[model samples]
Target: MKLSRPLVLLAVGAVVALALLAGIAYIFKLPPFREKGEIKAGEVCSSLGSSSNAVDALTKVLPEESSYSFDENIDLRTDVTDTNFESSCFVAGGGKQLLVAKARLMEDESATSWTQWVKGTASNEVSIQSLTPFTAGDTAVSSSRFAAVFVPCTSAGKAPGGQYNLSVSTELKQEGNTNDAAARDELIKLAKNAASYAHVKAKCDMAPNLGGTS
Candidate 1:
């Protein structure tokens, strides 16, 4: 059959249109888009370690005798509520990626000077299934692990009494296969020292008491 020039043009246009539609479909078939959030597990760990080092350097600048420690097994929990607070960040090699999680404390209704809005907001950020609850002595611990870039915190000006206290506790596991009470005690002591140093730094960062009798 003999084809006219107009027919050839029409066929070509149809082929082009089909190709364009296929390209568009392929683009739409991609995985659901998500915005990238800050630091991975490895990065967070490095940052936390770096922060500790920075504190040490700062202490050297001071005239007072300074001795600080770092807690390897830190437990974070909330005093205002029965629920515990925990977080962990780690990076896996191979095809697996890194994950960083930040768990915030929840407020109990019975607790005094508690902020409901802040608690609600923090709860929303928590991944419930990932959270693991544990207890040490009389204290309750809650922890969660995730892949994140930044540590989440309560929104400014939303906390109760314009203050939010985060308590971090740490314990040391056995060095080898054997779990000894003495080793555990030693680890706790080191962790307590670290926690004490961290508390001082936190207080300074939050509010510096400049006006006091020297």
Candidate 2:
């Protein structure tokens, strides 16, 4: 039987709409479209929507097209946040890659270890060759493509000297570009921003006199 003109037109329109919908779905699956997201941990980082600059800087490690996500768990005691953190709120432009992580400064050993490391590297005392945007905080440090910002905070537990377990820190370590001041500066921005997110999370208020994060 011959179909009416209106029926044929309607069929054609339906086919077109289906095709459009399919195209949209396919685009979203591609990395550039699909991988453009960060799992926000809320508070300061809530505003950390996917876009450019920091994320672009961070994704420099990815040779191919890239995407990113942010996470919050950090432990300074074991240095897991810096050395082993699978992800970060940090974004960098290192030749290879970079990461941001959080940790607690609960003891003198860790404090000395972390802070001294930054001071030495930032001052050029050490030679892995990192530069600085160098945002100052309660105590920040630098090393071979490594930077960490420490925010003062106290956890519930007490320390050996009757001190409270304190500090929320972020480490932005790049696999390369240790000597590029501009790149280091970007990493500093990324690190500080990540530290700020942690500062809010930690509820750090112990040293407001020392100029806490904004």
For TM-score, the strongest prediction is 2
Location of the lowest summed lDDT over 10 successive residues in candidate 1? 143-152
lDDT of 1 at 38: 28
Stretches of model 1 off by over 4 angstroms after superposition: 1-163, 171-174, 177-179, 204-214
lDDT for model 2, please.
Answer: 0.43
lDDT of 2 by residue, 3-49 (tens): 99999999999999988877886776653344433422332233122
RMSD, each candidate, Å? 18.5, 12.7
- Candidate 2 — which residues are off by over 4 angstroms? 1-64, 69-100, 108-113, 116-135, 155-179, 208-214
Clashes of 2: 8
TM-score of 1: 0.24
lDDT of 1 by residue, 46-100 (tens): 2133444423322222112112222232345433322344433222222233222
